[model samples]
Target chain A: MTSSSLIKSFERVKEDNRAALLTYTVGGDPDKKTSLNIFKSIAESGADIIECGLGHGANIGDGGAIQDSTYRALSGGIKTDDIFEIIEDFKKDYETDVIIMTYQNKIMAYGEEDFIKKCISSKVSGIICVDWPWPLNLDFAKKCKENSIVFIQLLCPTTNEDRLKNILNDAHEVVYYISMLSTTGQKLKVSSDEIKKRFNLIKKISPDKKCIIGFGITADTINDFKDTDACVVGSALCREITRSINEELNPATNVGNMVSDLKQKLSS
Target chain B: MKLEKGIPLIDQHDENGYWGGKFGGNQIAESLNYPIEELTREFEKLRNDETFIAERDYYFKNFVGAPTPFIKLENLTKHLGGAQIYCKLVSKATGGAHKAYNAVVHSLICKRLGKTYIGGDTGAGYAGKMLSMAAAKFNLKCKIFMGTKDVERQSINVFSMRSYGAEVVPVNSGSQTLVDAVSECMRWWTSENEEAHMCVGSTVGPTIFVKICAWSTAQISREMRKQVMDEFGEVPKDMKLINCVGGGSSAAGFWNEWIDYDNIELIGVEAGGPEGSSKHAAPLTNESPIGVLHGATQYVIQDDQGEIEETESISAGLDYPGVSPLHCFLKETGRARYTSASDEEALEAFQLVSKNEGFVSPSLEPSHAFAEAIKIAPKLSKDTIIVVDSCGDSAKDSKIIAERLGYKI
Candidate 1:
């Protein structure tokens, strides 16, 4: 997809007054079918975007809950290819945008161009290679554009202007600005005003692109996007889904309930 | 003619030949196999590379003050009544220890990798000291993860590291010691910003680290060669090189350059702690079988289930239950001999050295090396030249020894 198309999607989501529900689930958790069910449930529950997590042997960004989910997924024979199959199934059934978030090794192992082509064929809208910075991954961004897949760039609080400028220049679909210094599933301790201020700075720098604040975001803080284009809630939703699966509850029903509650909270 | 760049030196043997048959080529976990293998290959090229050799030679000769004057202890030799006793005074090295050589190379590699921050695990107190020096010299942000218990014990070194602008992170994990500090440092490297690189403090893992550490250690042997020529008018025919094995860096360093020599006997003195053959010995010498930790497969003092076993040594430096992979390979190949020294013996030797040489070498490493020398000295003639690495100065440890032994310093 072109940069203009991504801008259009961002504008449409912003105009609908709907906080984009970005869901994250480890591919093939418990089993492929169960994980696929979780993905379908999220898409059906009004998730505007899905992040299919490609679990690495060493997950630097994950906390305990997501770690356990990934362990369960791996033990159930979930591999990288299994994630693509699930994404393909989700695409056949739903019209939501899917993004693959993984480490650079995974992409390099699968061959970056081949991985991007697989994502395009599976109807994935974007890709987030976590460990690859913009300056280091300019060639990767070019490949993504050639394959009609948006290359998402991650920005953290520690990122200075020089690095941010590099990221904004290469960013295609959305800018995922991390709200806090810590990892996902952590509490959102930073103030909404502070987050808004950072988002405003990012927005001013990349005026045409959608800038979203992620990492440690929850349903309670969905309204923190008053001055931002989008707020992506991932780990919180993944945590709740994991809690349901661990408690032996119906994951789809529990996920539906959780997303509905989040929708209501976001709207209010 | 201009020398191009890096060159490969060490012959590429089958994994079993170089790794003691414990670390087979295919044994590395699938995830880390490529990077580690690539690193090993790169290291082979760098090891013999003319520039690397020249840089190593220059650092040893100038920076470390190599040919660290060999001191013959007439009193100790006469007291023992056997072989000629000599000490390779590594205490004269910059940073007051032999670790400076390896730390410089590690820091240089991190800088080459574009890492602005360098983190290391400290137990021998050498990594922190040497890396602190490297950080200041190289203008890199340095973080040291030291065991809380070790921090309390080695306050002077900790203070020195801080003085160098290194952030000393005290780790209170399992056993609150070096192993725990290493694990915590690895975790920190994974979680922290990607711009930082974790410098393995020893020659235990990647062949590149081993090669660099070995090059640093070769200073001792190189100096010994010169000393032998100066004293005996030739290289001594019956010479033995001795150093203590703590995570096996010094031992590997010394042996790496001399392993190909047919006549020299390379002996690694390991900590026996309180238990000799039972629990407390370092991994390569005692409990560990063939298993991977960090990056290389070596003898690890691990449990039946392959979990890393906790170690206890009076000396914090020797408490790690693992040794360098090349040392493991040497142990298997019969090129280098391995021995153990009890805490009691090491302490006794420490006292002996202090009284005889008027120099107290701190940490059990030098004492352990001395203990081995003492044991082996009786079997050899007075003309035999033996080199034991006096790894560090004992000024700091003297206080602890006095307090523990009820003696005045």
Candidate 2:
């Protein structure tokens, strides 16, 4: 997907008065084939944006669930470049926005400009650096902007006013608003009004940027962020994917059904 | 990228990196509720505070035994008939290891910050003991997380920490080792208030802790430099500083002074288990690719699939999957070189040093350093001086040694 298409995704969801569903899955949990099937299922399951995790087991943003999946993927021999392959396959079949969520080392090691170029070529819509703190990554973000790749920024519940102002004023296509300080896979509840209040703050700065809530969100807690532009359900999806693989169930069918259930809940 | 002066107990990001690198930067950034800038600013203020400095100085001089003895190992040097050897007896310091310095400094920081609790991780137990003692002195509650296996193996140290008024919690996470203990500590740090600081065990966490530990540990090099010059009339030209690299706290501390010097050789020895494998901890020697573990970019011993492998060693302290990023930078920049010794070799060094110099190191980590120093000593001329970091006394290792020797502990 191009940069415009990614923005169009949020616009399209807004038109229906239904929030976008941004689902996350790794490149190769058990192996590449299962990952492809999982991506295929996700693409057809009405996801508006796809957040694919890069393979690094030492993901600090995660708890046991996502960490275990990343380890399984890496232990399954998934490489950094393989994530692009999965994204490319998804783009071929679905119009959903594709974003690569990763730590900075993968890009730093690959050279920042080169990484941007590769993402562009892969039809990746945007990227979110989990560790890109405010103001430190402006140059990299600028480089990404120039290349037509959306440099997605993330803000947390605890992000202070000065820091949020600095980040949101020049925010690009999308901003990931973490629902809580806890890592992925924890059980937490966020009220719709509370999320709306946080969203209103970002809305004040850059009315154009897309906002989504992630971390500890699921079907039960979807209402909290369902009014926003998007809601990301990552570790929960990965957990179900792992269960399917471990139980000898069809990963493609299992993932498709799981995502479809969430999408249905969102639209209803 | 702007480079701050190379002082972090006082500064945060330098040209090298913040929170260390791409891998480590985000963990703290994403996890902590407190803004990193505020933490850095307050730390910078405390860096030059005279009250804190005086508190540290008074403890070192009066209570903890500052200026730990630097002695010429005459018998060991005579036995080798090669390089003259010296031992900086850090084992004689408070808590009986080089880790006490950082514990005291961090405890003082905790006090100044008005924190009620101080938490930290331990493997071999020296660092936990130091933190517990410091917390007791500072009137703050202390909690330590150690591996379940370590809690069993180093039971005496567990008892020692408990005796010092700390609550030692056994971590039953991945591998149940030092790396897991660190992970558990980070978990605890997140749940606690921002003011509640954890005594990071080594120079391997976020940039602030790395700088603080290195600065705190630098006391070894500082005291050693002054004493060596006083006794020998000039700095030894071919001086070699050897330290066992677990998380490389001692190496960072020992090498911080001489790192910029061209002639001095700084050697960090890693734990090489049965297969010369990193599956248990010899990253620099095993040449594990650079990855993030606990927020620092260094040689992490992970498999191709990116699963960090558990490290094995006779010394619990030396059995970590990675070392300090500063040590990694040193190895990459040629400021320091890394070597390794297998468990058998380290065990032999442990026995040899105890017999020859009447020194039994509490932790197995320094034995690797001793093993490396023994190999290097014989090839060097008599004028060359090799300084072995005797990091801790082996009283804690008595049970393990007895068990190893087929005696019931």
Candidate 3:
């Protein structure tokens, strides 16, 4: 699918007075079969875009919840190649916009050209390399465009105008603006006004691309995206899945409820 | 060849006809080649520039304590019962090491290249301290990357660096040590070219870096001449200069001024690791061949297929697998003799110096140099004067030695 179509889908969701549910699941988190089922479940439960996290051994940015998930994935013997296999399986059974959020080493290890080709073959819609900067990585940006893969640039609260302009100049598809300084699971104390101001500044620089705010965003924080293109609730949904696992509840049901509640709150 | 005034070390061809021949080209990444080349050319133009020279001289004299005193190791020499030993007290330099000299020069070079941010990788933490001081004095942004292991080990140095306003980025890749820190810094420098310049921590690269370090070493040699004249009334006829070689900075610093002096025998002591093992010895004296690395062609430890081999030594400062190209050339031509001291011998010497002289010389770098002095002193007469470049103090390494030797501090 083209990047334009994916952007259209998000716009349609906004038009329908519903939040774009961007569900995040660790690729091969438990196993390939379990993760594929989770991806299928996410697609069926009205997730507009599925973000599959490729876990690494040294996860500098991951918090406790994701760190445990990564360890479980590794203990279940999930290698990076298993991620592509899981994506291929999900693509065979489901049709939805897919984005791979991962560290740069996995891509470097896979060899850039081969990785792009595999993403293209799997029909992956976009990619967000967490540690890679947009300005310093123009070569990867060029290759991503050549392979018809949308490259998503991340802007944070600390991003200055010069860096923001540089990011926007090379950014494609969408831009994911981190709402705060802390990691995925950490509590964010910054107010909605602050987030909105940061988002507006980024929007001014990247007017052509969709801007989604992520990190510590929950059902209560849904209104934070009143000025944003979309709100991404990742850690909240993942936390619910963790709670369900501890309570012996079905994770699929818990995830479904979490996203549905956040969606309702966003719409209200 | 006539030496020019304020020219630092005189650039003269040796009788053996080697002029940075095999050891001189810093074989860095092709991406860095242009910037380094540009910097080198620009530094050549500015080296003799009055403003640059004035700034250098001022910083050296005031900030770094130029012409650091040369102290004779009379007590230690008498105990050893052979050659009289002296030390070029570089610990007197600001930031307490020889690194200030190289760091100031590189900082100036970066400023001339229009770089506002300076970064480096350090094992001894000397470069980090020096860069921090330079950054504070010059109003440039400075960031230093260190191995996580070194961070845990050198907490004092880390705190010292932060005290001077340098951001220390701890790198936790591949053994989480100096080598990995250097690789990560290279990656960062490549990505952040617009704002950052890598002020390399070693003196093993281009002629300019060597020349700057040589100037620092020349200070040692110049002071030694004065000390000898003050003590004995003339320049000593027979003198042996011994220094440790990691990436070969301190050794090169002392050797640069005396390369043309045929009467002075230059000796370099490398970490032998274990006697028979490659794990403890650095690459140049153990398992290395002719190859280019980090912008210079020199003796490099590489695998059979020519990939760089990772090296380890008890001393973090001596953990690199490549030696200065000039040192490699000197080794090949036999202008300087290279010897290896085992981790055990270095440790013994470390303890001996602390116990006898009340001087705690840290790491295996200084101890290794002293170990070599001990070995060679027995062969020389009592009148022979040997100068050892005491690179760093042992305060940073006391805990490690205490733990390894099972002794309570």
The prediction achieving the highest DockQ against the true structure is 2
Give candidate 3 misplaced runs (Cα > 4 Å).
A1-268, B1-20, B205-218, B274-277, B359-363
In Å, candidate 3's interface RMSD is 11.5
How much does candidate 1 score in TM-score? Answer: 0.62
TM-scores of the candidates in the order shown: 0.62, 0.87, 0.59
TM-score of each model's B chain? 0.87, 0.93, 0.89
Better of 2 and 3 by DockQ: 2
Residue-level lDDT of model 2, residues A1-268, one tens digit each, is: 4888888888888999999998888777777878878887887888888888884544456667777787788767687678777777767777777888887656655667778888887888888877555566678889888988888878877788887887887778788897766667787655667767988888788787888878878888776566678888998888888898789898788888989999988888
Q: Each candidate: fraction of true contacts kept?
A: 0.00, 0.20, 0.00
lDDT minimum window of 10 residues, candidate 3 chain B: B9-18
Per-prediction DockQ:
0.04, 0.26, 0.03
Chain A alone, TM-score for each of the models? 0.93, 0.95, 0.93
- Give Cα distance to truth, residue A146, candidate 3, Å: 32
List candidate 1 stretches off by more than 4 Å: A1-268, B1-62, B191-194, B275-278, B360-362
DockQ of 2: 0.26
